[model samples]
Target: MNIDEDTSAWLGCPTPLEMYKHQCAMLEDELTTAYQLLKKARANIAGLVQMNDLLATEKAAAESQLRSVSADLSRVHVQGSEMSKQIMSLKIIASQNEHLHIENQRLLLELSVLRGPRS
Candidate 1:
């Protein structure tokens, strides 16, 4: 019958201020949820950074140990080659000594035959 009642009846009885309050409350809830998600993401990022640092340190140590072992292996290989050369040299010397002893024994037999009448 009146203008206010007619407007309220047509607009379902909710005013502009009540609608604003309801929208504000929904925005606050969304903001709170967003803040919580941001905090968890930050914590996860920090943990990942710490893990990356630890892995880097371990990788450096492993590389260092690999280099050291490679150097030692190279030194052992050189020593083995030198030992093989020494063994060959000793074998040649022993063969020469055996040949010389045989020649001395033949020469001594010839001397004894030439001095046949010796008492």
Candidate 2:
């Protein structure tokens, strides 16, 4: 409780100079520990920064890919629409061909009868 320069200086056992040396050594040890902890903390911070940057970059890439996929889907839809139109046109043509075929068959039968029966 009474910390006078004379009473607490030498700690009542060691010389003043030895006490000073001991105090200096203890302070040096504490400073070294603090410095090491600061260095480790700094390294951790740097690693976290790098990780954050990588995540941001990956997010951007994913967004770009999503845009590209959306565009491709639009193109596919257009192509499908065109194919449907072509199929419809072909179906109409097939119907016309079928009608012509039936008419031709009727005409051929009539011609055979007009020419008379074969021996």
In model 1, the worst 10-residue window by lDDT is 2-11
- How many residue pairs clash in each candidate at the backbone level? 0, 0
What TM-score does candidate 2 get on C-alpha atoms? 0.55
What is candidate 2's lDDT per residue for 89-115, written digit by digit as tens?
999999999999999999999999999
**Model 1, range 1-119, lDDT digits (tens) per residue?**
55554566565867889899999999999999999999999999999999999999999999999999999999999999999999999999999989999999999999989889688
How big is the positional error of residue 78 in model 2, measured in Å on the Cα after superposition?
Answer: 0.8
Which pairs of residues have clashing backbones in candidate 2? none
Off by over 4 Å in 2: 1-42
TM-score of each: 0.59, 0.55
Q: Which stretches of candidate 1 lie over 4 Å from their true place?
A: 1-13, 84-119
Best by TM-score: 1
Give the total clashing residue pairs for model 2. Answer: 0
Quick one: how many clashes does candidate 1 have? Answer: 0
